[model samples]
Target: MPSISRSTPMRCAATSKRPGCRRSACRAPRRTGSITCGGRTSAANCPTTAARCSPGGAALGEAPDVVFVVADGLSAFAAAKQALPLLSAVRPKLEGWRIGPVVVARQARVALGDEIGELLGARLVAMLIGERPGLSSPDSLGVYLTYAPKVGCHDAQRNCVSNVRPEGLPYDAAAHKLHYLLTHARRLGLTGVGLKDDSDALLPAARTEAERLAAE
Candidate 1:
């Protein structure tokens, strides 16, 4: 439901990708900062209290290639781990960008996207987050890229990729989707405004990478 005035981005109703556990597993999630866990409503629901968005939502850095934040799972622990786990791995690729803290609530993620775009002075903001946990795709991940920063902008103004766990979109594929979204977002100067397609490129790259890793 990440849409202000645009098409509603799909928010799959699923929860917890913490291996083969009951749907209720990973429930009662905990969070850091003033954010909330367990439900959609959180401390960030208010605009003022929301964590500072933007690549360097708090700092002004060089025009970054792109600004991104990932919310792994709704649980506070999930979000924290998402940011810290790959700190060393993702740091270099994000050289021109400052990785912001992971945020929950698709709406907040959308807000962060706008904040990043406004702060970076870039055309788009990509917020990669864990999708809502559901029976259809509990472990899936989502990526939301917006053209501009404003409240209630709508979903059509953004682009998204979902079902990002093994049985769904793989990490490599998700990365590729991210790569194309960034490139396309730069080219189109808008995500969801007109005709655009990047799914083919994303799946191939992801599959190839997965196969390559398997060979090793």
Candidate 2:
């Protein structure tokens, strides 16, 4: 695993990627791990299939072209009520998206990548999750973006947006950035280690603003 002391790239983009990996490289299932999100445990790790962390089955209706892994805390539901508005503005572009139930997991960040990708046939995935609680902040939300979805995708092809509490990366801002990166990754045909960050082009103004705000 790489250290967290590295300086990376792009304003809206994030992750450690492995472009060399093929889908066949990892055929393992997500290890049995546990996590607590949105006051519930991960469905993937559920003792029974009926208790799945995600919403499924034909009765729930057709799966959208996209799957959203929402890691929730007890308060994530409320935070998401505020956060969804931020994502809602971009819904038109992500026309086939289906925001599902919040899933708790032992390692939710990566679990979301595999879960979202397989269900949606997506080449790339973005997880809007609840960060682990800290002394100073517990309500904070985050986004982890990645390429090439699969189980055991540790440190492989991705980035994250942290501190989405009232003072951190706000919902509207984060949503814009997420969409921008996803589009660029798709258009460039880049993912994993090969994914170039084109987010700088889409939101130079925002990056500058983010920097300016952080510096303040």
Candidate 3:
């Protein structure tokens, strides 16, 4: 298992004149004009993923092209407890077929999906996580998919499908969007901004479903 840290320095786009500017915390520049820093660098507002922290070993006997992971948070069975019902409902729909290993990562984070997928040698990884309870929807769930996951992979590289709940994004619709992105990500060899959500167009009655869901 590799030690994962959220402290990895990333490129900073902020100008030097920005308020509370500190240069000492930043690392050496990789690309000129972009500053590297551990805190408050360019895109500092974005969340960071762990560096490595993968435990499951490499893929065994016909590795799955895509791996689905369930990582609950620090709370007592919070992730699993919340995810089980959804999983149970979704499992039958996903039955029969070469769907990759479904790893139950209890007490884990979103980054763990990347690590495990990399370890398993999977081309793509989709991790379902429990979101913190908001006043609107207490049982919100989030899904994240990464292509070619490995150590040091950034959060930006992953595609996220969030607000998966009864009132929010429905389970069936979320599954469709995930399937659509997974296929396209493998084809394009990427996931973030470059890959647009044209999955709606691929589906019948595009505008109806598109208007109904909040994928963005």
Candidate 4:
């Protein structure tokens, strides 16, 4: 895991068209334990070993409503290809919410978002990470949403949207689900197993179909 200290320069674009949005990149240190990377000992040897941050600038006294972290988990290809498109799809749905910078991390884990969110003083954190590669899907992305993010948060405390790829879950569908989760999590003040994903039921087509079935 990469250590974040106050001394670490967290810089963002001062002239960015999007208010509060800044981009920063960081490199994770090499680990001591033996790890397999293309049969090499160090996982750092992998092509994608740096983490990046693109934060939405916040007012001096105010924290952003949410922070977005894009990590290259097991597949950097997934992050490189899908992160921006997914963000573009979701941003429209998040109108009026304070979104912190977007962080792109190399050799990152999902939990890294917690630390980043804490550092930014955000109300919630969303981590979009690359899933472990599969024989058929080498570039699948996954999304994890955590409320009141902090270090030591258990997996049970987060909600996940997985297999986010063109061949898997379409960006629009994934964004819709994410918007629903973010809105409800803020309102209900929780995530993880406690917050179920029932967004499918709220879709106009789904609802209309269900009503038609009921009328029959």
Candidate 5:
């Protein structure tokens, strides 16, 4: 599904590092006019609506650092009603050189993100997918990041961050991990099994500060 486009960067001021639910009604009023999608006003009131893609298709400007595409397991109609909205809500906070919306069909596979990313000429691509509901975890989001995405890239060439939700990985932590991976991916010019996530390790300066503070 195509969605509206925005020139403004995505930033959430109220977001905090503590683990807490981040779900809030689309509260930020639009400073700029709405971008239409499918001949209708982008759901500006609903955060997701702001990122809701135009069903008719939208053009890509300069390739963004990352492009987020949604692939949900729900029926097309139902996914459009639910998944798209949720992903759209995060569009504003997704800081990058540029980003755009992409909607995939129901039951789509991970390869779709690669194809879309290659087509859009993005340096990297992140796919937000809905995982099957489980007894303990009913709603979970899975993220896959592919560097230099193109058709025929193997799954081993991508990096995955899974079990993301309010009760699980927490949005802030997930974003931090994603940012870490993206930064390293661009510098190393690669992603997948070879790349490692060491973001949890304390920095040298932080470790020194911790020891000094402890001594006091």
Candidate 6:
């Protein structure tokens, strides 16, 4: 798997020695503006956090097709370990899309991606956050994709892909599902409730199983 270099100055809360999550000793970008959490504004300037062009060489000034936000929610370890690998896995699938820099947010909520995406002028935002720790799955990661991300967007306007970890949904499957959602969201011009996850029907294995059941 390809290593994801850290473009932002923000340090990973957890140990950064993971395979794909290597830290890049690059200079920090100039910070400006604050991010709103819940109702109150913070001086931390979370929205303009970090941005880099995709492998496709999109210009920084242009609004990207998709913006990815990685937040260390309940378990920073989950974000530290899983975020980059998942990004690496999914990036090739999004060859033609304009991808914005990976934004790493501290003290972030899933809704925080809206503000970040709005600031970046992204058509879609994908928030990959650490899920609440469970006894058996403390490092589970969850992804939320929203179309036309803005400050006031609600949960009903986003589509979720959860339990993204080796022990759970796994990277490849999660990437496949996310790619499917993104492709359909852009084509259909919407996400959340109106969009359905019928990706399983497109899977070769699923089709084979269905055909066998029908023959039986």
The lDDT per prediction is 0.47, 0.46, 0.57, 0.67, 0.56, 0.70
Q: Pick the candidate with the highest lDDT.
A: 6
lDDT of 4 by residue, 1-216 (tens): 432222111121111124543433322222111111121122446422222223333222368888787777788788767776788788888879987666555456676677667767889999888899998879888999999987778899999988787777767878888999999999999999999999977776644543454354
lDDT of 4: 0.67
Which sections of candidate 2 miss by over 4 Å? 1-65, 73-82, 95-109, 135-137
Tell how far residue 62 is off in model 5, in angstroms: 1.4
Which lDDT tens digits does candidate 5 get at residues 53-172? 322333466777776665553223323333334344445455544654343433445666676677667899887676667767566767789999887788899998776665565555
CA-only RMSD, every prediction: 10.3, 14.1, 14.9, 10.1, 10.9, 8.8
Worst 10 residues of 2 by lDDT: 2-11
Which runs in model 1 stand beyond 4 Å of their true positions? 1-57, 72-109, 201-216
Q: Residue 168, candidate 3: how far off, in angstroms?
A: 0.5
Off by over 4 Å in 4: 1-61, 204-216
Question: For model 3, which pairs clash?
Answer: 12-42, 13-42
- The sequence of per-residue lDDT tens digits that candidate 2 reaches over residues 1-216 is 111110111111112245753323322223222222221233335523212234232122343333345444334543443334444544556644443322223233345445445444556656666666676666676666666565555554666666654345555566676777666666665555566556646766766666665556
Better of 5 and 6 by lDDT: 6
Per-candidate TM-scores read 0.55, 0.55, 0.63, 0.69, 0.60, 0.72
lDDT (C-alpha) at residue 6 in model 4: 21
Question: What does candidate 6's lDDT look like per residue over 1-216, in tens digits?
Answer: 111222321223222444764335323434322333421123234432222122322225788899888887667789877887788788889988988767766556777787677777889999999999998878889999999988778889999998888777767778888999999999999989999998766676634544454354
TM-score top scorer = 6
Ten-residue stretch with the least lDDT total in model 3: 6-15
Quality of model 6 by C-alpha lDDT: 0.70
After TM-score superposition, what is the CA distance of residue 212 in candidate 3 from its true location, in Å? 6.5
Clashes of 3: 2
